[model samples]
Target: MQIIMSGLIMGCIYGLAALGLVLIYKTTMVVNFAQGEMAMLTTFISFGLLTKYNFSYFVSFTGALIVSLILGAVIYAVFMNRVQAADHLNQIVITLGLFLIINGVAGLLWGHQPESFPTPFSDKVIPIGSALITRNDIFIFIFTLLLMGVLYVLFNFTKIGLAMRASAQDLTASRLMGIKVPLVFMSTWAIGTVLGSVAGMMTAPLTFLSPTMMFDILIMAFASAVLGGFVYMPGVIIGGLIIGVFGNVVSYYYSPEMKVVYTFLLIIIILYIRPQGIFGGKQTVKKV
Candidate 1:
């Protein structure tokens, strides 16, 4: 039971990581391959603030978020905005370049070693009947759920959210309707970066801070996003939880090393069966 609980906590973190991917894909129709690197970089920022300046968690978190948002905006202004008629391949190449740059920068700044991170929750474990859960696990689960709820409300009830949705659906139409399309695009990237940074901070305590931490988790998060449907929030969350639980079950039943292999296989099977994703509807392509 403790193991199951641990998997669920980890799944929530993956879901948060995938949420950033979904946000970017939904709005821009571009998969930012650099997302993992962005998370890693922001986490390093938090670590620097905490270790060098001895800043509080909240302060460091805020600073990291701000820096990440600025980075996201700059990436868009410098690269994404210039891709006027570029294909998906071009966008992917650009993002991949960003990924290498960020990864290299992180390694240069922090070295290739793992660093300890302070957790807001106590390390003590509490027992509920036969099941034992740590405060950190509970904190991660609750924090992720809270963030999801906030995002749900923002996308469902806010005007800006509606504009974003409109832009995603039809950018030219939305622009013609007087919406600030570029701003909406920038906002989407900003939100994605902020969420990614938060996921990084939350995960650092569990996984330890390393230059390559996001590299491994990024694959799982992408699988989660694909399994859930690129634009479906609820589906993404459920997919993440399923992957987390399933991976752990596999690990327990077999070797722990097979977890990633099983996850990728599961993703491939799901894609083969439902290419639009479990929650995604088939999009009709208009005849040109």
Candidate 2:
């Protein structure tokens, strides 16, 4: 029960990050390799606001998310928009460039030292049966769920969400129907970045804050996205939970060092068996 509960909490973190990745992929048809770095950068910014400037946690958190939103929009407008008509490989290269740039910038600014992140959550422990859980763990779980719920409501019930969905489905058709494709694209990036920022904020407290903090988590998040079906939303959530549980169980029974290796192997095997992913719909190839 302890391992399972811990896995579920960690799964929510992975799921949140993967959700951001899914959003960008769904709308722009581009995998943002810089997703983790972007989150890390904003997290550092939040840390500065909290410690250096002596701001409240709420203010720091909201400020970081807003900055992430703007940064995402700026990247899309100034870089991605120019390369919008390029091949997919070109877009990917651009994001890879961003990954390197952001990582280096973060290291230079933050000095590559790891620091403990401050959290508003209490450190109190709660006992459930034979398992012990931290208050922060429960807080993380609820916060992630609330974020997911907001996204669901936005995507399913709002006009902007409809436009976003339509834009993702068919860019030209959506434009023909009076949807502003560019704006939709920008908004998608903004929202994705905001999600990533939230993931980063939640994550920093568990792990120490550092420039490279998000690297391993990013890998797990990518695996989660692949397992859940890159284009499907709910699948991402389920996939994250599966990964969390699998990794914890492996660490418990086997070598902790081998856990990541086994996790990747499991993902590869599952993909080989079901190319479309567990919950992913069958792909339709268009004949031109």
Candidate 3:
């Protein structure tokens, strides 16, 4: 139970991170390698708001999210949109550049020292089957579920979601259907960044805040996305959970240092057997 809970907690954060990756890819056809950096930067924003500006927690949270929204939108408008027609290599390079730039700015602003993140939940621990877990663990799991629910509803039932879906499915068709493709795409990036920021904020409370804080999370998030398949949102999320649990279990039974190496080994082995990922090779399209 202890192992399971620990893995789930980490998995939830990873899944959130991966979800942001998949979200942009599905709509924009570009993998934002800088997703983690954006998360890290927004987290720093929240921390500064809380620590330096002496703002309330809620204000800091909202302020960070608002900054994330603008950050996403501006990146899309100024950078991603221009590269949308470029080769994948160019897009990847651009995102990597963004990653470097963001990381550098964060370091200059916040330094590399780790600082404790304020936890929103109580520190009380509860036991289940002789295994103890904190309120934050439960909160992470519950929050992830609720967020997924909201996303599911947004993707399935709303006009904006439908437009976004159409844009993802067929960009030219979306334009012909009178949808403002760029606007939809801009919104997608905005939403994707917001998602990543949430993941970043959630992660800080679990570990500590630093400029390089998201390095490990980014690697694990890609692993989760690869494991679950890139296009399937639910699949990537489940993949994250699997990665989290498997990594935790391996660390518990084997070596903590090799957990990441072993986790990728698992992903590679699975890919060897099924190259399309656990959830790949099948694209589900909703026809209206």
Candidate 4:
């Protein structure tokens, strides 16, 4: 039960992070290698707001999300927009460059030390059958579920969401339909960044705040996204949960160090058996 609970908590975090990556890919066709670093940077911003300015946790959280929105817009306007017409490799290289730059900036600003992040949730341990878990764990689960619910409503019942979907499916057609494709693209990045920030802030308390802290989680997030069919948004969550449970089960039964190895092995096996991923749909072939 303990291992299962741990996996679910961590899986929610991975799902949020993977959502950001998949969002960018769906809209801009770019695999954002910088997603984790961007999240780390925003998480540090929240840390600074909490520690340096002594803001309340709620205020710091709101401030960090606002910063994330602006950062995402600026990045898209100044960097990603310029490479929009480039080939896939060029676009990917730009994201990789962003990954490096964000990491360096985070290290320089926050230094190399890991710090304990404060959370509003109580640290008191609670018993669940034979397993013990912190209140924070339960809070994290509730928070993630609420967040996903909000996203579902936004995407399903909002005009901006409709525009984003149109833009993702057919950018040229969206423009012809007067959808302001550029604005949609910018909004997509902003939304994705905000999601990433939420994941980062939640994860910091579990894993300590540091520049390199998100790298490992990022790997799992990538695995999750790929496993779920990178273009499918909701499937990312399922993929994350699967990866998380698989990792935890492996760790419990085998060596903890072998968990990551086996997780990737699982990915390879799953992909080999079902190349389109668990939820990936049929691909459309465009014949010349």
Better of 2 and 3 by TM-score: 2
lDDT of each: 0.87, 0.91, 0.92, 0.90
CA lDDT of 93 in candidate 2? Answer: 99
Best by lDDT: 3
* Clashing pairs in model 2, backbone N/Cα/C closer than 3 A: none
lDDT of 1 by residue, 106-158 (tens): 89988998988888767899997778888878878888889899998989899
Please provide TM-scores, in order, for all candidate models, with all chains considered together: 0.96, 0.97, 0.96, 0.97
Per-residue lDDT over 1-288 for candidate 4, one digit per residue giving the tens place of the 0 to 100 score: 889889988998999999998988888888888988999999999999999999999999999999999999999999999988899999999999999999998888879999999987777899999888888888878888887888888888999989988987777789899898778889989989998888999899998999998998899999999899988878998899888888999999998999889999999999999998889988886655
Q: Which stretches of candidate 4 lie above 4 Å from their native place?
A: none
In terms of lDDT, model 4 sits at 0.90
- Residue lDDT tens for model 2, 5-98: 9888888888889999999999888899999999999999999999999999999999999999999999999888988889999999999999
TM-score of 4: 0.97
Model 3: residue 138 alpha-carbon error in angstroms: 1.6
TM-score of 3: 0.96
- Order of quality (lDDT): 3, 2, 4, 1
189: Cα error in model 3, Å = 0.7
Error of 3 at 35 (Å): 0.3
Residue 19 lDDT, candidate 4, scale 0-100: 91
TM-score of 2: 0.97
List, residue by residue over 1-288, the lDDT tens digit for candidate 3. 889889988999999999999999999899999999999999999998999999987799999999999999999999999989899999999999999999999889888999999977789999989689988788789989998998999999999899999998888899999999889989999999998898999899988999888999999999999999988999999999999999999999999999999999999999999988998886666778
